[model samples]
Target: MATEHGIPKLRIVEPSFDSPLTSVIIDLEKLRDNRLDSKTHPGIFFQIKHIFQLLESLGSARIEGNNTTIAELVEKEISGSRNDDEIIGDDEINEIRNAERAMDFIESRIKNNSKIDQAFILNLHKIVVE
Candidate 1:
């Protein structure tokens, strides 16, 4: 391609349009170099659509919210059982039981509220990305 100074810019070959969006690899540097300030670029538009599609795809792995479960709390209890001896006294056991109750409450909310899973996953995303 011709440049501003009439020099040739390297031609970047386009990938097949037949492939899925998941197969597309975005060039963040090239995108930011030109697109960070440009509003009308299809690159940014498609990327956002791609991201939204990905987030929507998460609904696929979703558990049936119709069931009652505090899987996280249950998992915590199971994990804690692995180191059972670490709890030395009746007081500590009571504390652990209290924690378990709190987890159960959170789990109940997760099971009942339709929006809870999305928020939980979003929080998980923030934690992971941060």
Candidate 2:
């Protein structure tokens, strides 16, 4: 740590060359590669992946205090239909839809072998934000 012009600057810690965590990282990578081979079972993998994306979208909405449920989200996603009895707001529904579309874009890019660079991320962010 150092001070410059009466402002304290924190020291940055550099990572070590080797550590016990390296083995864990390697094992996790192997597991990920083995299990995430969508080519092996494209149909089931995409279905499960879509479910996970929906759950992730739901979690994001919940973090923002949106009370939209998975069932409601799926119903809206499937048919764009909303029940008159349900009092969910348009903002909540839109947030869920935005996340779903963002995830879909990412999936599409991956399927198309598109590079996940800064430009790609910015494009995805644009889709999600607007």
Candidate 3:
């Protein structure tokens, strides 16, 4: 494979059924480089940025608001502990619905042998969590 933009070559190892599954250590730096060009692609950016922003905001919120607001938000975001009527805004509710729809779509695609990757999962996570 050819390297692009200082990107390292991808190392794909195919294992035989006779052999035990071998370790395939991934180089995160290479992975990052491979995906860098997708930042401009809205589909990829939507999910990646959502996670990145959520994490960044949570970090910032802790520094600024400390445990009070940040903790509550984190709990509400992760679990269904929060009262839906109060905590879930209009947009957030829509996001949840959209996430479910996207997941279903992905399942269907994979069933039909037309599947997506990180972009799909990222979008789903972003929708539900962010």
Instruction: Say which candidate scores most in TM-score.
Output: 2
Candidate 2 regions off by >4 Å?
1-20, 32-45, 78-89
Q: Which ten residues in a row have the lowest lDDT in candidate 2?
A: 80-89
Using TM-score as the measure, name the better of candidate 1 and candidate 2: 2
C-alpha lDDT values of all predictions = 0.46, 0.77, 0.53
* For every candidate, C-alpha RMSD to the true structure in Å: 19.5, 6.8, 15.1
Superior by lDDT: candidate 1 or candidate 2: 2
lDDT of 2 by residue, 24-101 (tens): 777788886674434658788878877888799899879989899887788786784644334355878877767778
Runs of candidate 1 exceeding 4 Å displacement = 1-89, 114-130
Better of 1 and 3 by lDDT: 3
Tens digit of lDDT per residue, candidate 3, span 4-110? 68776777778765554532323444564573444277887777765555555455435543343434555666887544335345443334334444555566677
Candidates' TM-scores? 0.21, 0.61, 0.27
Q: Please give the lDDT score for candidate 2.
A: 0.77
For model 3, which pairs clash?
none
Residue 35 lDDT, candidate 1, scale 0-100:
33
lDDT of 1 by residue, 11-84 (tens): 86676766554254554445646835456678888777644543332332233222223353245446755243
